[model samples]
Target: MYQFDKRIVMTLDAGGTNFVFSAIRSNEEIVEPITLPSNGNNLEKCLETMVTGFTAIKLKLPEAPVAISFAFPGPADYVNGIIGDLKNLPAFQGGVALGAFLRKHFGIPVFINNDGDLFAYGEALAGALPEVNRMLQEAGKNKVYKNLVGITLGTGFGGGVVRDGELFLGDNGAAAEVWVLRDKRQPVYGVEEGISIRAIKREYAQLSGDLRMLSPKDIFEIAEGKQAGNMVAARETFNHAGEVLGEAIASINAVVDGIVVIGGGIIAAYKYLIPAVMRELNGTLEMYEGTSVDRMEMKAFFLDDVADRDAFLVSTSRRIMVPGTTETIEYDSVKKMGVIMTRLGTSKAIAFGAYAFALNELDKC
Candidate 1:
């Protein structure tokens, strides 16, 4: 997804080793990136590296950047650009004012956010949210969505929320920490135990009666019947993971209603994952009084399925006339939500997210 606004924004893909710096305009990279060692163990060196890299990017850009925006691993006060103690970067042990320093150095606005929040923002602005709306419009629906929940499945389950074009960072800047949800299969363990890369390997090992520590990709190939392992075990592994992921999403929807979009390396195996997810989401909840309620008020549909998409796009809204007046209004009775995989790859989504976020904030100023 590309931004049409021509304003320039400098961005970084902050990593433990190489700190990548580039400038973006119209939601696309405009200059070759400069990479420098992060020196994450040394704050002085880390700060210097960022300054150097951003300076180089600025020199190569066609014009001055309007702001600086990027993602960093966080236990942060993102509203103020103060990073808290991080496990990956020891130099950020204290509340370091990363954003304030960048603003001072570049003499422009600086905004820093975590990847999860930005991922959802990116999708809400230009990716899954827009695509879903377009599909609904094509199907002759008048309902337009303005909220989204984006999740990533890989090393750890992560999530973020976007409501009406704004990234919904909570009061403490820790919203949508879905990995910490209780596992559906093992209540004692975090949900990530059932939904992540390690979860796939561990489950496949136990199911196939093999302990060779096969990679997740290998297990996926096995499930595809292209590798020499138990196809049943591999498919079962992903199914269990999807169940846990769906449980987490159901819980999230209770608080924030939105279309859900999934991404990350683990999504390569989504063929085996999403069906279980829909089952779990559409499953019922039982009350102490012995009554059963739908887990979600709206039915969850996987957008990739032609039948599901058709069902989701079928709206049951009606025009109602007022009793006391000539006024009439439209009312929607059918409830539904769509879930889909990312359209933009994860990295590009994050990059464009940063670029778009910077411009949006600037416009508000």
Candidate 2:
């Protein structure tokens, strides 16, 4: 939203094998990215690579960067920028003060955070949240939203919460770890077991007597009757993921009470997943007395559904008179939430998140 801000932030896209570094100004990349090997098994080389990458970007800029910010794999002390044991980057298994090293080297403020958190923050700052509000305004509605929950469904299930334009990083730096929740379909496994790439393949394979694994893309195509695979089995696989994802999101919504935006590769098949998600959200829970209660207090609407999007944008407020006075005030009592796929690509969202976060924090100082 603050695309006119003049401050520059150095950012990187850290991956398992490489570090792609660049500088962001006005919420956009200002230069071509510089790449370097991550050398994840060797701490010394990995650290050096990060420094080199940032330094190269720094030299190309005519202006000094005000801060350094980027996302890394988590299980980290993000507040202090210390990385914990990472399965992909084994050299950090013993913990490393990555943020501190960068600050000392560059003599600028350094901020590090989980990718999920940054992704949510980015969307909250510039993507889905604002777009929805703009829609409401254009529709001449008074309803406005101030919170969002963003999730990524790719290699694993991941999420972040943003409220009132602030990313919610909970105590112990482990907030929004949705993947660890118990799977409803498999009590012995985490929810991630039923919501990831592998989940689609595993479920599709198990559905057929031949028991062959297939990529999620190919399976989705099969479900569209465009490829040579079991169509029913492929559709069921996505439904399975949707059921578990819905459970996790509904539980999260109880606390967040906001809009939900989903990203990652799997969301491309939202058509198949969202119906199952809606079923679980609108489903009921049983009481000891055999009464069925709505699954969530706030009804979750899939925004891709044209009718649902219209409902979400409609104003539910009206003027009400006080019981014992002549005074009246406008009030709204609708409790609802909307979920949709991310319009902004995940990587761009993360980069914008880093850029916005750094500028915000710098302003505080």
In order, the Cα lDDT scores of the candidates are 0.88, 0.88
lDDT of 1 by residue, 1-365 (tens): 34778889999998877899988898788888888899999999999999999989988988788899998887788889999998768899879999999899889999999887888888888899999999988988777999999898877788889999888888887887677799998999999899999999999998889888688899999999999999999999999999999999999976788899998899999999999999999999999999999998888899989899888888778899888999999988767888999988887888888988888888888
TM-score of each: 0.92, 0.95
Off by over 4 Å in 1: 317-331
Clashing pairs in 1: none
lDDT of 1: 0.88
In order of listing, the candidates' clash counts read 0, 0
Error of 2 at 117 (Å): 0.2
lDDT score, candidate 2: 0.88
